[model samples]
Target: MVKQMEERHSIWLRIFHWTNMIAITLLVLTGFYIHAPESFRLFSNMDTPRMLHFAMAYVLVFGVIGRVYYAIVAKDAKNVLFNPIPDIKNLPSMMKYYLFLSDSHPDYGKYNPGQKMMYTGWLVMAICMIITGFILYNPNLFMGLGGSLGGLIAVRVIHYIINWLFVLSVLAHVYLDVSEGIPVLLSMFTGKIPKGFHDSAHTHDKSIGA
Candidate 1:
């Protein structure tokens, strides 16, 4: 069979994707260590992890900004951002397909409804994390914000909870991508996929459904 390829991710997107991935990974690790030094002895000293965590935080900040800018400039927001009415309507079909109760679902553009929801949620979560994080990092600077949110301790708790969400969601994201196939997983890195891969998969599923 002849293999044809198509662009699935742009160069700028791939850069942002990897940048965010690395920053998030480091942030999680360093975050855990910072949260419980005794429990998570990933690092021997607090200074190292604390410094690394703060550094990665800035990297993630820039990464998110760059990604959003690119999305708007490239008109790729529609491909990933969730549109409530239609996406909500399509969720049942997506859920059924994932549950193995159905073999095929109506096309959901670049991302399925669940994926769109998750990606959109991540964006929201990231923004929340940045806000809470800064409030904690510089309690003096964001004193008023922290006081409104119930102090630095509360902000810390919120940031920690969001970090856990990021960890769990990232695991789910990786699993779902790999489950789609190696091509789907590699597409992020290679920025290309076999042409008609998604279409062919859906067509086969439709045949099975029929």
Candidate 2:
């Protein structure tokens, strides 16, 4: 009898992943529209941009929270939220593997070392954005953060910067699916991966790195 494999990304992840794709794309479009193209105002003075930006911001914030919620409820949040903490010990080893030095460094199961690091960075950056956003949203309420406006501004800057990083990650993610010889796209949509690939991962084989 063949050892039956199970799906990793649940229905909720599929829903949120696609929903987030939509929200993030809209945010980018509305964000760029309002970003200093002075002659191309869609509302005579860019009033529409502000409304759209705020709306998308709300959606993104809520969507992120929902994703974290699902990750928690699904019991895989620990690995998804924060794994591979990227310590000094793993630093050299991870680099070696990336440089093709050694493929036996470690087996990261669902997310490899680099991906875990990215996820960690995303979580921290998202928290920073949320905090700074609150400050900017209601500076009056955050009494001690009067001088914290600079921090809020910093978060704004980082938020935009991370947007590209996020997009880049998405690109790399897609490219890996296509180039790495895997049906990652279909797995995402159908919540299924070839059992051989799944087995490779569970068995900690040399070809399981994703």
Candidate 3:
């Protein structure tokens, strides 16, 4: 039987998701240019790359802030934040479902435990990227701790290390989207999903009901 899906994503959610796609792509492009070897310079001057990188950072930060705020204010946002379902208790089973070993796992209402885990991981990583980013932004502060400290140089190393983590997360995020998020995105863009998809993704049918 064809299952009619409940509309889970609203207009604002779709907008934010796509907005992030643009901003993040630009940020990554400029960021790589800035961090890449000088011999492989993409720009005639460092000024353009630096400015664009910073500008994209600012936009990304605002998006992150908005996401957090929405988590507190929006019901769907709770799926990622509060995540009432999916704890250590259910992780094993959910993993099986993802691997296709099981026909199904527990039904999710907003987000599955697996989805919540990824969301929570990214939220925290984004925040850390912001904070550690500032630390590198001002290395003199680290020097105050001790003159022997490499100061900003040390901070640069730390920042550089974290940057890779964020990069890896993005790669993983892309892969997951290709797997499950693709279907979700299609649903968001079209405002519909396979009815069975809705039943499996969310816990309560009533919440998704039109």
Candidate 4:
């Protein structure tokens, strides 16, 4: 059977997604080496990794800005941004689907509640990392803010903890995406999905309602 292709992601969104992924992957690797020069042997010396880390930090910063701009102008924010009241109400159904207790979940716009939560989380985490990273990067520049945030030590701890969170979250994201089937994964690259793919979720919801 032929599967019609439908555009799920825009060209710019795909660009930003891949670029952000690359930037984050480099940041994590460099972060590990920087965190423990003795343990992570990915980098031979501090110079290269430190330089790369700083460069990728800037890359991610711009990526985030551009992605947010695109989301706003393209009217895509509604698809991913979590709306507290409605999202809270819809969370149970999404949880049931993931837990195998339910076969279908509500059609919560382009993204379901869980995806909205994760994507929203990554945004929050990214912002936190950026702020903490700068504080750590330039102690003197952010001296006042750093002191308010419990001094440089607190900022370092926040940066380190969030780095771990990013690693774990990315691992789960990769596994879940792969488990969903390659098409779902490929959609990130191709910006298209098999026709009727998204409809399947709502199909069951409607059937149950009827």
User: Which candidate ranks first by lDDT, i.e. highest?
Assistant: 1
| TM-scores of the models, in the order given | 0.95, 0.72, 0.76, 0.94
Q: Rate the local accuracy (lDDT) of all candidates.
A: 0.89, 0.64, 0.65, 0.88
**Residue 83's lDDT in candidate 2:** 45
Tens-place lDDT per residue, model 3, 1-210, is: 545566767676776666666676776566667778475467777788778767767777888887777767775665776354446677787788767777666765567676677778767766765655556555556456423434566655655665677677778777765666456658768766655665544322323422
Candidate 1 per-residue C-alpha lDDT over 58-123 given as tens digits, one digit per residue, 9 for 90 to 100: 999999999999999999999889999999999898888888887777888889999999999999
| Model 4, span 80-187: residue lDDT tens | 899899999999988888888877777788888778888999999999999999988999998998999999888999999999999999998899788666777899
Better of 2 and 3 by lDDT: 3
lDDT of 2: 0.64
Better of 2 and 3 by TM-score: 3
User: What is the descending lDDT order?
Assistant: 1, 4, 3, 2
Candidate 3 wrong stretches, greater than 4 Å: 1-5, 39-44, 82-86, 138-150, 200-210
In terms of lDDT, the poorest run of 10 residues in model 2 is 198-207
Residue 155 displacement (Å), model 1: 0.3
